[model samples]
Target: MNTVQLERMKNDKGFIAALDQSGGSTPKALANYGIAQDAYKDEAEMFQLVHEMRTRIMKSTAFTKEKILAAILFENTMDLKVDGQYSADYLWETKGIVPILKVDKGLADLENGVQLMKPIPNLETLLARAQERHIFGTKMRSVIKEVNEAGIKAIVKQQFEIAKVIIAAGFVPIIEPEVDIHTVNKQAAEDILKKELIEQLKSLTPDQKVMFKLTIPEVDSFYEVLADHPNVVRVVALSGGYSREEANSKLSRNRKLIASFSRALTEGLNANQSDAEFDQMIGQSIQSIYEASIQP
Candidate 1:
């Protein structure tokens, strides 16, 4: 990374805080007195320790551009406080790192810059850019979904639209629908997944594919209905308000239901595999589908 980007990563407050907590010794102390006694022993051992430590630290501390971007997107908080007073001037002075007030203006500027630069072209462009930078992995996509779920649909839709424009440009109109699962009942959720959405999805294009964002509990019934329609390319199941562990546990319990849908869709897609292998692939596919559904 360039010096400017490196500076931005190093200057992140959360990252700096994490580093401070990771090492009991402050940067000042480390520069002045060398390694702490508790962290090592003897002069020779300390020398060796410092060498090993420096190598490991450099390896761990060198943050990538994508990491910085992800942190800004996911971990940034907008709560401005200037001398216990809240005001636009105070927020401006603090650079939008406040707790209570909004950062709409600052964010608008950033979004405008991103738009001008055309960072995202389409789904393919986005994926290609990520892959070219070696950060387009399944895990990173999962992180994108998590960030999208945090109610940042405008940003997410812009990215999704860009991706669609790049990959299947002019072939079909891809609709990016943002579904809210907060306090929504099963019937309401099912209604959203029904023929209404299917017709809307089909209306996008003759060959357009629909990607649905659904909570874990809504997957079985949701897909069961979708399974009847052979046009659906994917059913991306999302875990609303669930941690990664909890989502995985819930998904595991519903593996059979997912496998059934996967099996049914596989025949339509002409992708052949054994039932057992199909189950595993469906699990992995569902994870990726969910990851891809939401933008980072």
Candidate 2:
């Protein structure tokens, strides 16, 4: 791992920007940004349009290292450019924000009440490309819809199993096992998950380090133990499905867990806004999220 990036990630005060919406989620992400399905006719055009939107965000003066510790990028975006530079390189070199690639193919069909990541057969090749671009780390996600201890264990286990490979490849891994916010027994599931994660952390060697991107727990700071774990670099909260205001409110309560929000972070942005309007909007979003990320 790059020691400068590692040091920044270990003690950075700002939140991560999740700009990694994938193939399955792109339509929804575009729709939320005021682009309809009819706006782009095919996958190629759709990706092109979304890339434009991302370029706008990245090139904005508002998007900088002071308020953004890092950004999680899609594979498509990783291969593309921003203002004449590779997306990852632009983020780190020009803006001082670490760039991370989302490496999971997608989620598998639910089994045992959980959704594991689809196989990433090309992860080794992907990591090599990322390394060449000065990328710092990788993130992969799976989901838990309800409380099933066996299923939850499977999710965490899968995350770590892949994380070890990522570690060996010399990159940090941000393992995200998202718990559905709508689950009636969400707290119960988180409790079981907390225990399983502790067991996994205890098993790691001192040199191993990983970051976690998790849902804002039902109770404030419920994952403090995980946050404080020596093997962990930082603990970040996913907004899940909350509105931006609601996400920020909940995030402030967690204190230690910084934001790695997708929808919530880009809730009001639109492709139609003028440059001045766009910058102001993103600036406000960054400020709100930064405040919550560093909340005491």
Which one is best on lDDT?
Answer: 2
lDDT digits (tens) for residues 1-296 of candidate 1: 12333333223221110111012223222333334566655444544443333222212222222221111110111121224432222222323221111001111232311211123224454334323332211101101122222233343444344434432532111122323344335444345335344443343444443333344554534444553444443333444445444554554544212211111111111113344554454344334333332221
What are the lDDT figures for the candidates, one per model? 0.30, 0.92
Estimate TM-scores for all models.
Answer: 0.31, 0.98
Worst 10 residues of 1 by lDDT: 13-22
lDDT per residue (tens digit) for residues 60-113 in model 2: 999989999999999999989988899999999889999999999999999988
| Each candidate's clash count | 11, 0
What does candidate 1 score in Cα RMSD to the true structure? 19.7
Total backbone collisions, model 1: 11
